[model samples]
Target: MYVVKSPLPDADLKTVADALQGALVDLVDLALVAKQVHWNVVGPRFRSVHLQLDEVVASARTHSDTVAERASALGVSPDGRAATVAASSGISSVPAGWVKDSDAVGALADALGTVITRMRQRIASTAEPDPVSQDIFIAVTADLEKHHWMFQAENA
Candidate 1:
């Protein structure tokens, strides 16, 4: 059983909150990309991409929850509030107009790169709280990178 730790250093609390918020915000962007790809995907690979999009979104949501809970465990509030996520997220927003199916993958790749960069920054700065958060970020990065590569290959 996992025992929750209390009285975390205030500095580490802030660091962990920032890290969690960043990850969760990126996760929301991941969800958005998946939805965009699902809705806009066309051509021979349509069904495959569509299915994968939904699957990826589901995974993103799960990771978001895990990050949020981890923040709570560390005596920090989840920083995934909508306004904070929107204002602080590093992921580039999708344009307002319609997106081409082929181009959607590239857009998602950009967002993935943005998220990875932010997580890597956090990994560099965070000194404590819990190692699990960093591990989660790393795992998410791996999955997101793989997704980006698959989409990039398809784009070619």
Candidate 2:
């Protein structure tokens, strides 16, 4: 919308940007929440769960950067401010205080699953108007799905 001379129409770019921004916000939120779980998880599986949570946090941060960069490349400013992320992210609120390892795993898995579902929707939304943007979401989806599986495995 900001005078980007891309082959994709401004309208399409705007749509893709919106989807990317929303996902970016959620990814940022998820990353922080994952760190929260990592720092506070307790119980018999503490070490494994804590380490796995670090991996989740790392993945979320990396994916968020990719999504934000894509939005910027498309001429839309990526809204990653804490206020914007708090308001726009679709991830559920993380529990406060110490979290049980099993509970943390389940909660993180649920959050990843929610983002994965939204990513699939974003992918479909961009498919017709911007295949490149759709491809970006496609790659994101694969990574998120892999993470989701890894997180869920923690519960099993």
Candidate 3:
């Protein structure tokens, strides 16, 4: 933990920061998966899916930054290195070979849905201890849900 003073106690800051760090890891993993799909998607919808995935990647990256920054504001060290993300993130690894458009969409939708579920849990956990942290989780969840819908729509 850093030396910055905050209204929240050290314990609460540590708790919230831990949750935020987990979320950050997942977001970073999600961005990498989205980009993997973007680069490998094939089939008739290839171009559209490829392009749309960039939006997901961008969202994940932005959310990761926000979460990491929040953790820092609370005097926690934000660990966003690739090794940390790989070790901490819950998202499944995307396959190495080229992926079909449908497969990529399905995989991404599932991953997004999983992250949204975890985000909601994080939001609930933060509510009483830190409503501001809850708000951050809420905002991230909403954005992820929107992207979830978009990605799932690709499979329909």
Candidate 4:
């Protein structure tokens, strides 16, 4: 039962909801992965990479909240549960042990790239159905891209 009704038509709402849910899962996973790496990263660049991972964690968390709220506004329940994220996230699983600083950088860059690619798809899918959601995806993609660039440069 949808206590909050959506203004969008049923078909459009479905499209937008799918995009929003996918985005939420990706963002949540991104935050978790970054935080895990932040805790385990080592090597000469450890200090810098650890700090950079925190930046990514912060951005992912902030964007995840925005995406979840947007979904709620549109009458879709956002599932940010760990199980849901693990099942639906587009990002690959993070390794389970201490990660070298360069490896951490590469891993984060790869994860960011994966999320950005999917965010672009969500942006397109929501464009006509819900421009507001599309705009959120666009903004999220831009921020993730910036982090991706920084991580890539860490190894350069």
Q: Can you tell me which runs of candidate 3 are displaced by over 4 Å?
A: none
Q: What is the C-alpha local distance difference test score of each model?
A: 0.73, 0.87, 0.89, 0.95
What tens digits encode model 3's per-residue C-alpha lDDT throughout 19-135?
899899999999998998898889888998888899999999999999988887887778999999888888888889899889989999999998998898899888888998899
Model 4 TM: 0.98
Clashing pairs in 3: none
Better of 2 and 4 by lDDT: 4
In angstroms, give how far residue 30 of model 2 lies from its true place.
1.1
Give one digit per residue, the lDDT tens place, for model 2 in 1-156: 355455668788778878988889988998988998888999999999899889888888998998888887777888899999889888899878999989998998999998989999998898888888789888888987888898788778
Evaluation by TM-score, superior candidate among 1 and 3: 3
Residues 32-61, candidate 4: write the lDDT tens digits.
999999999999988989999999999999
Listed in order, each prediction's TM-score against the native is 0.83, 0.93, 0.95, 0.98
Kindly give the stretch of ten consecutive residues in candidate 2 with the minimal lDDT sum.
1-10
Number of the top-ranking candidate, with lDDT as the measure: 4
lDDT per residue (tens digit) for residues 53-103 in model 1? 787788788888887887777766666667776787777777655556666
lDDT of 2: 0.87
Global local distance difference test of model 4: 0.95
Q: List the residue pairs that clash in candidate 4.
A: none
Order the numbered candidates by lDDT, best leading: 4, 3, 2, 1
Model 4 residue runs over 4 Å out of place are: none
* Runs off by more than 4 Å, candidate 2: 1-4
Per-residue lDDT for 79 in model 3? Answer: 92
